[model samples]
Target: MGFDGPTFAFHPDRRAQLRAELDAYYARLYGLIRDELSYILDPADVMGDDYPSETFRVLKNNELREFW
Candidate 1:
């Protein structure tokens, strides 16, 4: 995942900004989706009191395939 040399031959200057924006966007989107599902009948808080706590940390801001 680490690219050496120029990050982007076309738009290297915007790499930092883009990465930060993507991270935040995904974070908010993840929070919203979790709220929508309400934990698929289990009633869980993905964010938990301490986020990045193994379980939620593993799936941080990303959807994982559950059934099929």
Candidate 2:
């Protein structure tokens, strides 16, 4: 079976828009952590010593899927 509809079309512009929005969201989140939370807790301690991989793991984990 096949489907035909305007919604089925691939939209690069929409994809770019979403990507930009996601980047902005993360930038704001990190900015808040740096400005406000850094005084109370070291970002390294909160994020652990290995931050990039740990952050990726937390984001990709199943438990966060629902929240996302």
Candidate 3:
């Protein structure tokens, strides 16, 4: 479902771009802005030490490198 459409193959760069685009789309679909997306990606943006659990850590880091 979340692929490069026609190719439908696994290429690191293409997948990352698609994933980031999907992330942004869903965020907007839910009426969340950039800052809210940031917070959702890494809860630490809103809850620092109080919420030290790593949620979507890898995804967030990858998105930072590829899109954000």
Candidate 4:
């Protein structure tokens, strides 16, 4: 299986914004509440200071810009 549709180019910023929007839409469809989505984007919010390295930091930042 592969993409067969026409392709168009988008600036890096625009592509990130679009990806964030799509992720948020799917999160809603999957029944993720705001808090759940937030956690998925940034586990550090709920994790303790000694917790391991950050998770999805880039996605979290991108979503903050595009979703919030």
Best by lDDT: 3
Model 1 steric clash pairs? none
- The Cα error of candidate 3 at residue 49, in Å, is 6.8
RMSD of 2: 9.0
Model 4 residue 46 distance off true place after TM-score fit, in angstroms: 3.2
Runs of candidate 4 with Cα error greater than 4 angstroms are 1-10, 53-68
**lDDT tens string, model 2, 1-68?**
76665566667678668866776677687775543443233344566666543434554365346535
lDDT of each: 0.50, 0.55, 0.79, 0.75
For all predicted structures, in order, the TM-scores are 0.30, 0.34, 0.57, 0.54
| Residue lDDT tens for model 4, 1-68 | 98999897758789778878997898989999887776676667767656676677676576679756
Using TM-score as the measure, the top candidate is: 3
Clashing pairs in 4: none
How are the candidates ranked when ordered by TM-score, highest leading?
3, 4, 2, 1
Error of 3 at 48 (Å): 4.4
Say which prediction, candidate 3 or candidate 4, comes out ahead on lDDT.
Answer: 3
Each candidate: RMSD: 11.6, 9.0, 6.0, 5.7
Candidate 3 local lDDT, residue 3? 59
lDDT against true structure, model 2? 0.55
TM-score: model 2 vs. ground truth? 0.34
